[model samples]
Target: MLATTPKPPYYAVIFTSIRTSYDKEYIETAKKMEHLASLQEGYLGHESAREEVGITVSYWKDLESIKHWKSQSDHLLAQQKGRDKWYAAFKTRICLVERDYGFEREEQT
Candidate 1:
């Protein structure tokens, strides 16, 4: 599902990764991180997908919120695990969303 984010001026953290192997814990940790992020002060929403590569884009109120999320304790441990065991490679990019638009068709009953 696509995330419904607030208007422009929001920040997005785009995390792209290639996994090492199917670690049973990866899914659980990912869920945990998403839940934790939702509870944070400036979190807006997120969307994610995984095929040959994994991508997660989380929206926030500002860069400060992104920074806080990065330094969060559990997230810190998860980051270490991703680096040491889960991810073969990963890249993160932060961008200010100046504008966005999309369309969703209504489902037929």
Candidate 2:
């Protein structure tokens, strides 16, 4: 995952993976992680997708939250499983999102 820190009021964690061929269990595990991640503090938002590669971008309030998420037992186990069975390779890139500029195209007008 290639990521750049925008400036520094927020944080972004990018998780990218090249996955091995899978069966039905993949969906079950992914859903479980998504649910678990939502319960974490400082978690702002996330986006993810996979084609030839899988990528998930999780937004956080600060570096502390990022650290916490990384160390969570379940997450750690998933990391191990990914390395051992699920992923061909993976990378995580963390960046401080200091500034952001975007607009809502949908207006209330």
Candidate 3:
């Protein structure tokens, strides 16, 4: 499912990666990070997908929130694990979302 984000003026942390391999630990850590992010102070929402390459875009209220998430202890460990084991390569891009729009189909009974 797509993330339901607030109106404009938020931050988007786009994490794109090439995985070395997917293991049980990687799956568990990814789930943990998703849950932890949802509980954070300024987390908006996130959307993720994995195939040949993995992409996860997490939404935040501001840069401070993004920084806090980065420095979070478990997340820090996850980062190291990614470097050492999980990811062959990765790129993270933080951007200011100035404007946005989308369309959603209506639910039918």
- How well does candidate 3 match the true structure in TM-score terms? 0.96
For residues 1-109, what per-residue lDDT tens digits would candidate 1 score against the true structure?
A: 8888988889999999999975969989999999999999899999999999999999999999999999999999999999999999999999999999889999999
Span of ten consecutive residues with least summed lDDT in model 3: 19-28
Q: Determine which window of 10 residues in candidate 1 has minimal summed lDDT.
A: 21-30
Per-candidate TM-scores read: 0.96, 0.83, 0.96
Write candidate 2's Cα lDDT for 1-109 as tens digits: 2233244588888999998885446677888887788789877778888898898998888889889988989888877777788888899999977677754466576
Count the clashes in each prediction.
0, 2, 0
Indicate the worst ten consecutive residues by lDDT in candidate 2: 1-10
Better by lDDT, candidate 3 or 1: 3
In the range 1-109, model 3's lDDT, one tens digit per residue, is: 9999999999999999999955749988999999999999999999999999999999999999999999999999999999999888999999999999999999999
Stretches of candidate 3 off by over 4 Å are: none
Please list the residue runs of candidate 2 whose C-alpha ends up more than 4 Å from where it truly belongs after superposition. 1-8, 107-109
CA deviation > 4 Å runs, candidate 1: none
